[model samples]
Structure formats: C-alpha cells, structure tokens
Target: MIYQKQECNGALYQMCLYSMGTMPGMSPRQRAGRRRTTEKAKQEINRRQRKWRLMQLINANFVSGRDLFVCLTYAPEASRARALEKFHAKMKKAYAKIGLTYKYIAVTEEHDMDGEPVRLHHHLILSGAHGVQLAEVVRDCWASGLADVRTLREGADFFEDTAIYLLKEDCHKGKGARRYSTSRNLTPPAEPVRLRLGEEEEAEVPPGVKIIEHVQNANEFGRYEVMVGRIYNQAAFSAWWAAQRRKAAPDPWERLRRRRQRKV
Candidate 1:
C-alpha cells in the first residue's frame, strides 16, 4: 500500500511538471528552444502578411498601358524627404497645368556611391493618360537632377515584376520608414471569391481565366492557380477562423462561478 501511494504521488508530481512545461522529458533549455521557434513563426507570419498587403495594393492600382514607371534623382544638398515632397508638389502642379489627374506609387531608396556620400532617389509608377510626354513633363517638373520615365512593356506581368523590383532586398530591409507609398486616391484590390468544395467535386476555372499552377501542403495553406496568380483557400481559412472563435468563446458556467466568487 505504501509503494502504491508513492507511485501515485510520483505520477501526480510528473503531471504538475508537465502542465508547467517542465517535465523530465522537456528540460528548461527545451522550453526556451520552443519559445524561440514560436518567435520565428510569429516573425514569418508578420512577414507574409506584409507581403500580401503590398501585393494586394499593387494588384489593385497597376494598369499595363496607362501607367508610367519613373526614376527621379535630386541634388546632394536636399534631404530625402524634402526632395520627395518638392517633387510631388511639382508634379501635381504640372499635371494640373495640363488639365489631367494622376495617381502614383513610389518607393524611396538610398545608395552610397564609391567615395561619395549616400544619395537618395525614388522609383515611381505613375498613372495617367499621358504618353511619351510624361517623361518630358517629369524632367521639366523635377528641376533638381534627372528623371527617367518609361511605359510598362506590352504583355508583361505588371504586378509580379513591379512588386518584385520594388520589394527587392535593399528596399525590404528594416530602414525605420515605409519602403513604399501610394496616393490616397488609389483603389484596393477586390476580395477573392471563396467556394466550398465537396469530396467529389472539382474546382472549376472560369471561362476567361487560365490556370497557371496549384499548390497544396500540410504546413502551408493550399491554393488554386487561376488567371493572374495563386488564390488561397478562403473557405478553409474562414472555417478555421470560425473554429478558433468557438474555442476562444467565454464559458458561461465559468463566468457565473467567477461572479459568485467575487460576491463572496
């Protein structure tokens, strides 16, 4: 009887340690390692969310033929922020003079030239009806150093190429400021339609859209390829979110017990 009681005490002690994440099989170091892994996972989630938001914003406003890509440089005497502000003001005035409206997305970057101080520049995607004259207008309006403008090439994937270029290694680094900005007038992308599928039913592609590729995995979300790019499984995501909310819901009995304890 004493031996059995001791065994029961040992089991209870081990259960307590397990609940505190300090069981014999899991050392403090292992718990700390798990924490590091969780932090990495959180960072990855934040990174992916940022990328998705940027892609969505770009996809909404980008137009192949109507938009112009521009690079602007300024004199060394001017600050980066001041140069950008002045350039924007000048461009707005110039467009107003021409009786046209414009929208733009811009990315700023700084480069340290060989044996020279760091220089600031901008890459801009401007939307307007202006053609080749856009470059001339930018050059004239800039009045600082130089402005190079070109139209997006025909048959090119505007979102893919532009997003990749804008979010390149140098631009994506944590630089204490936003890497890119867009005009407030720019529109957002439409939310993708979610369709639930049965075990036997296959996902159908619309008439005009073409399938590029499909991806499925246990770790990451499954997505179907159609038209422009991969579309994530929104139905699955919605279901998952609903389940999480249900799990996180407050227990009525627990709440009542808490109230009773408070009254005592």
Candidate 2:
C-alpha cells in the first residue's frame, strides 16, 4: 500500500478470477478425483507456483521510479557461497557509508561447477534510498565486477517477465538448490481476491485506473482468469466513490406507507 501511494502509475491492484470443476455439474472434489499426476506435470505445477508467488511479491512491493531491477556479477571466486559472502560484506559497508536502509529480494542462478565458477551472478529487485544515488552506490559496492542497473518498466507484463526470468534460476536440472532470498525488513504483497465470473467477464476496477493486462482461460475441467493493472489517478476515484456511497436510497415500501396514511 505504501508503494502504491508513492507510485503515480504503477499497478494499484492485482485481481484474479478462478473456478474449477463447475463446468455444468461436476464438483471440484470430483474433478480432483479424476485428475492424474505425473513427474512432468508435478514439475510444471511447482514451476507455476514458484513463479506466481514471486510475481505477487513483485506486484505488492514494487512501483515505478522507486524500484530497480539489477543484475549483479562478481569476479572469479572459489564458489558461489564465497562470492555472495564477499558481496554482502561490501554491501553492508556501503549501506553504512551512505547511512541508508533498504530491502531487496535476490535470485542467484546456477553455478558453473565445471567451469571457472565466475558465472555466478544475482538478479535483485531493490528499493531506493532517500537523497542518494542507489544504482551508483550498488555499482561502487559491487567493485568486483559489473553491475547492470535498470529502472522498472511501467506495466504488468514487465513484472510478469521479471518473475518468469527469475523463476528460471530454480530449475537447476534437479540439483535441488535454494531458489531466492529476501531481506527480513520487506513487507508482504497484497492478498489475492478469489471470485467467480460469468463467461467473458473482466476484472472490475474503478475509473481512472488502467488495465495493463487481462487474461482468460477455460477448459473442460476448470477456468482461470487474471487481471493485472495500475492506477493513474487515485484522487478522482476516491471522490467518485464517496459521492456514490453518500447518495440516499429512498425505500419504496416506506413511500407507499406514507401515501396510504395521507389517503386515510
């Protein structure tokens, strides 16, 4: 919520509409009973779950202009562990020097076990600092190698693409490694709203907000739809909502009772 308030154009809401096993008359329990699991199917499910959670995190905490998508690399080290250790030490010092506090989530890809082990790098979603050049600070702290810093693009697809790219780090060919790590101070993403929709129905948002992405899917067994987007003008929507809620609703029954009393 704080992030959304700060962002004038970032996504204000993330909404989803999903239904399963209600096609005609089948219950969800019945659909589950009919479903089968395979290794590939299981892997695919895991991948989507991982990506979905990561996307939620992004959508909740990140907004345009105040967040960064960074790729951090390092000089050759003995192992990924050693390189990360050294990087953290440097970052700690840098933070102290800048008198800054921040939160971040980082994904470390696979290590080149057969090669020189220099390819170990991290992709980070980082928050900005007040009155300081965050990217330059990160670059200076990363002294060992290269730091590619970029601003967040304004759209749901950019967020989706980022989540998908980071999810790739988890698929290390069955090596069973850790996925990603986050700073302890970071806040949680928005809770997803569960709902059912009619055919071709879209996620509803107030006026002045833009729908960055809307997708729908259905099958014989289930249906899934999601709408991801941003708000450009919060003030106008607030005013409209207030006006609508305050409008009085005259009761027809009360009006009829008053008329009958007058007649009597």
Candidate 3:
C-alpha cells in the first residue's frame, strides 16, 4: 500500500508537469526553455485580452455622431493624477454653467522619451452635439496645457483603428494602474451570445458581412475570427465565458489544502 501511494504521487507530479508543457525527463535547460516560452505566450494572451476589453468598452459607450474626441495634455512638470482630478472638477463646473449633461470615456498615458521626463496626457471621447462649444469649454477649463477637440467622423472605425491608436501607448503599462476610465453614465458592453459549434459545422456568418481576416488555430482551442465589427452575438459569448470560468474553477477543498501546504 505504501509503495502504491508513492507510485501514485510520482505519477501525479509527472502529470502536473506534463500539463504545464514540461515532462519528467526534461533536462534543466529544456525545462527553462519551456518555462520562458510559456511565460511569453501568457503575456501575449494577456495583452490581446486587454486590448479587446478596451475596444469593447469604447464601442459600447461612444457614439460616432454624438461624441467628440479630445486630447488633453499637461505641462511637463504637472502631476498626472492630480491634474486629471482637477481637470474633471473644472469640466463639471464648466458644463453646468453651459447647462449640458455629458458622458465621457478618458484614457491617461505617459510618453516615455530617451532622456526627458515622461509626458503625461489624456485622450477623451465626450458625448454631446456641440463639438465647437465643447472644445472651447474644454480648452478654457484645462489650464495646465493644450486641449485639442474634434468631431468623430461619420462611418470611421472608431472601435478599431481609433481605439487602438488611443490605447496603444498605455496598454503595455501592465496591471499596476487603470489604462482608461469613463463617466458613470456610460453604457457597458452588452453580454455576448454563446454558440457552440460541432467539429464539422462552420461558425455562423451573417449575410452581407465582409470577412476582414481569418485566424486558424489562433489559440489552444483552435479559435477563428470574422470581423463583423461591433455586431457579434454578445449574449452567446458572455454565456460561453461564464461556463468556461465555472469549468476551470478549482475545488474549494483543494484550494484550502494547497493553502495549508503553503503555510507548512
């Protein structure tokens, strides 16, 4: 029985390493190589997910016809967080005087140069019909530096090209700080619709939708993509995501056991 228990433990250890893309017989160098590769893959996935989430938020909230894009910058010596807070306060007061209620999504970023200090700035998408007035108010309100505001062009791909441009600077900043924020009134992304395809059945493509590009075996699950822009089945996707989370969740007792082992 003792010998059987030892064998089982060894088998479990080997299985765990195998699942992690390593094996029992790997040399130290091979193990290290695999570890680096795994870490790189994880980082790439995380980066993609962050970009996707940012795009979703922008698509859900921003209206091309109603909202204006504004870039707000601060002086080289200004504290970014404090300047942003003050800017928001001033904007609220200014909008109130004009009798306009507004919704906005703002992203803060710092441009890192070779020798100079990082230059902090903000990109905002503000919802209102008065583009010129809004621009004038923002320019006057932001005393620290320049404010550049413009109307979002009709039929322009704000969710794709514009969002990518605005977020590219700060997306790589990691999880230490929020890359973007929005007014409480902004609408959240709708839940995605979940659809499970059989091994042979192709994923549904709505009529008249152009396929921008296709990716085969994009990830571990052999995912594919058809760029229908912001028109995908959100409800289906959300349900599928929730199901995956439940499937991947660890047993509570197993988590407790691991915690106790770590304590020991």
- What TM-score, over all chains together, does every model reach? 0.56, 0.58, 0.60
Give the residue spans of candidate 2 off by over 4 A.
1-10, 21-56, 59-68, 77-79, 111-118, 134-140, 143-145, 149-158, 170-178, 195-209, 232-264
Where is model 2 poorest over a 10-residue stretch in terms of lDDT? Answer: 1-10
TM-score of 3: 0.60
Report the lDDT tens digits of candidate 1 across residue range 67-102: 788888877664555767777888888888888776
Full ranking by TM-score:
3, 2, 1
lDDT of 3 by residue, 53-152 (tens): 5656666666666678888887776556577777778888877777776677787766543323466778888766644357788888788888998886
Candidate with better TM-score, 1 vs 3 = 3
In model 2, pairs of residues that clash are none
**Tens-digit per-residue lDDT, 1-264, candidate 2:** 000111122345444444422244657764563243223333444555566667767766776667888898766743445665566667767777767555678888654434334466788888765455777877876766788998866454537777877776454645466678887766676433233345455445657667776665555444444555566677876664455334423356977999999999
- Candidate 2 TM-score over all chains jointly: 0.58
Q: Can you tell me which runs of candidate 3 are displaced by over 4 Å?
A: 1-49, 76-81, 112-118, 154-158, 196-201, 218-227, 230-264
Error of 2 at 212 (Å): 2.7
Q: Which stretches of candidate 1 lie over 4 Å from their true place?
A: 1-42, 76-81, 111-118, 130-132, 154-158, 169-172, 191-264
Candidate 2's clash total is 0
Q: Which candidate's TM-score is highest?
A: 3
